[model samples]
Target: MKREIENKSKKKVIIKRQDECLRPSIPQFSVFEIIRATNGKLIAGSDDLSVSGVSTDTRTLSRGNLFIAIRGKNFDGHNFINQAIVKGAQAIIVESDFRFDASQGASRINKDNLSLKDCASVSFIRTDDAIGALCNLAAFHRRRFKIPVVGITGSCGKTTTKEMVADVLSAKFNVLKNKGTFNNSIGVSHTLLGLNKEVDIALVEMGTSNFGEIKRLAEIVAPSIGIITNVGYSHLEFFKTIDSICNEKYDLVKNLKHPFIAILNGDDMRLRKKAKTSKDLNLFTFGLKKTCDFTATNIECARGVLEFSLNKKHRFKINVLGRQNAYNVLAAISCGVIFGLNYKDIKNKLSAFIMPSTRISLKKIRGYHVIDDTYNSNPLSLEYAIQTLSEFDTKGKKVFVMGDMLELGKRSVMLHREIAKKIIKSGIDTLITVGPLSHHAADAIKTKKRSNLKVYSCGCTLEARGILLNLLRDDDLVLVKGSRGMRMEEIIEDL
Candidate 1:
């Protein structure tokens, strides 16, 4: 079943892959158990009522479900209490500060007044913070299961590495993973809550834009294993420096259990330095470097697929695009080794790794080979995408449609111009910019006055859409990418 949980930031997390997570065969949770898990108080109903699943949004609540009333910047779940009750929510977890507002559909309950039974014996519980309670209950639920939970965080390839690790683990285990970019506090909680009797292990991707978020997610997940893909220029608006980003990412390793097993990119100098000084974590290094614990050599990308040899003996061929993904693959291979899976099993499962199309995917769209990396963008990811596009053996011209990269704070323009320098050195023939910041890249390119490179600077995607429809030719290789807020995917849709 599809579920959407709106966190405090108003991010609507829509679960796409039902089979991968949120299994129907879940362990049962009673009202009393939730109270213990969340440190919540039973306000008006008996503590004996039980539920098999929990939901934050009333729109996705099912019969016999326990709905947690969440408050967000744009919406509040307490206002939808009547809808959840009418839809057969067995219990409700509301904030302790909530008061009865029948006009707004708020549920009224008190210690002496247990008669508000709009539904059959509905239970009501109160907590200081519903979101914290949700995370706390998820943490409590995670401890009940005895399985290796791998928590991954990095500026790039968090989702890709999560998928690759899940694919490898699935060879010998019933692996569980989050759907889409559900890597924030609420997303990780929902993913942990998806644990059931059937789940052999869980892979939780931790994503953050601010400090302390990764630490909070790590506490909620309590993973046995951890991975940091790499540290780079990502979300600099909240974290103004690379050192701060490194410190934030190290939170995953720091919050992992004592004597933790952390798989990290040895090529990232910060991570390697941290690994050298780590006292609690048993670090495993994976990269193309020969000094790494798990090294990948002989890397190649052909027909938009990555092929590499692990430790120069075991080979891996995956469908994920870009040569940079060899690092992502090596991270998963390290985790597979940690799982005690044989080299042959890891090899057999490597082929099953499918690149999420919304990420760095190469596709034949409208008669052209299109690389739709429109899911999100940062300086590091965008630079690699440009390299992947420029190196691609296409029969026609190479075009890059870049949108504004968000959250860079003061360095947005400088980073954009920096991408322009990279593009100028590459084989790209045409550059089309979608938003204001990327226009800086286009302007930087125009100053060179090179006849071989053509530039189109637009104020928005609507302007770029019309130009691309007429400019694109058959057998062309096009790269469309931008930050999530810019909605760069609209250009590909028009194409």
Candidate 2:
């Protein structure tokens, strides 16, 4: 999986991950087809032209790539048209108001210059919105296939459930899962655009930080089945209440047409209530609760594995440390069962499923057991991490090095401080805070007056790293985590 992150210098930094494939499994398309999908007017080059694939950044543009001039809060792709042409873009999709200049591979665009030889080398599409054109074209191409598409979403466990569902389906079919947390409208479009003949199923993970994103993604995915892991305190900056989060995630189920399957987390009473009114769906629920269609029992974690029994009959052991993963596993298993896979096959497939290193990983470093979950953080996941720490059998004191959890909106500080209650019960000996919000957690813990616990607050990750380096002992167990901006990995990377 490859994702683009912009640094302080305004340059795009591409990080390539090992678990997922970043290379294109894309099919080729003709200029006329793209124009038809995008409702674009051809301005230059022959309508018969073809492009190998699509790209947004000139830094990675290949010779036959169709470049879309997408505008963002910080940068505009239109400003790099000349650079894209020099990098060998076969076509360009620009806004309707974009006027061509001589530097755009040929002389300034005009009716008389439509047949210019220089401009003929590159095709052009003028659309009202470039980003909308990209999604339109992708949805058009997606209409070409009639395979089973599974759309997965939730506040937490979306990626894990998506990966596990993909792994289970891959045992019997060729599956293409969206890479990483690329669950935005743009990322979902890219996944649909990559569909080809060899794929039997498309597993798309949808994420939303605001309203309407899930509905838009569902409009593109047209899923045969949808999985919602759980709606919790995620993206609370935009979605202020749990009820709003519930409604936002339910868009996946509501947008689906008749006769579609809706899989939900049964333990979430909110989802269960939603499922009651959704009588039109072929509903399935999974969790640790007995009433669920698929439920796990005898949950246990030892070393680096999680063991659970489904429906009190079939047993499964997966490579993971978090007992909270039982919910994610049950969701994946429910999907496999709905897809007509036998319990034997599902068991074999799931037993071999190794969650991506990005989710969470337990490692040994210099005689210390380190749990790294620095990908991103939210209240529910943080609570689960603390529970895992509390249950762990450590030879030395258990320590939690947490940074601020972002996107909580007005309740940001309260939520941080709220997590202090979980920390007190976790039996962890030390807490190191790394941001202003996390400072609230430190203050709350101090108010409790826990004599056995020690706390430290720092303004930055570097200061936290220095504190940890001096505070840790030989056999201590440590967990490091934060939201994307806090860079919490600094505490464990070298220590």
Model 1 agreement with the true structure over 101-155: per-residue lDDT tens digits:
4433333433223335554477888999999999999998887776667899999
Q: Against the hidden reference, what TM-scores do the models get?
A: 0.91, 0.91
Q: Which ten residues in a row have the lowest lDDT in candidate 1?
A: 7-16
Instruction: Quote the lDDT for 22 in model 2.
Output: 30
List runs of model 2 lying over 4 Å from the truth: 1-25, 103-116
Task: Give the alpha carbon lDDT tens digit for every residue of 324-346 in model 2.
Answer: 99999888887776665677888
Alpha carbon lDDT of each predicted model = 0.84, 0.84
Candidate 1, superposed: residue stretches over 4 Å from native = 1-24, 101-116
Give the Å error, residue 314, model 1. Answer: 2.5
lDDT of 2 at 226: 87
CA lDDT of 457 in candidate 1?
A: 94
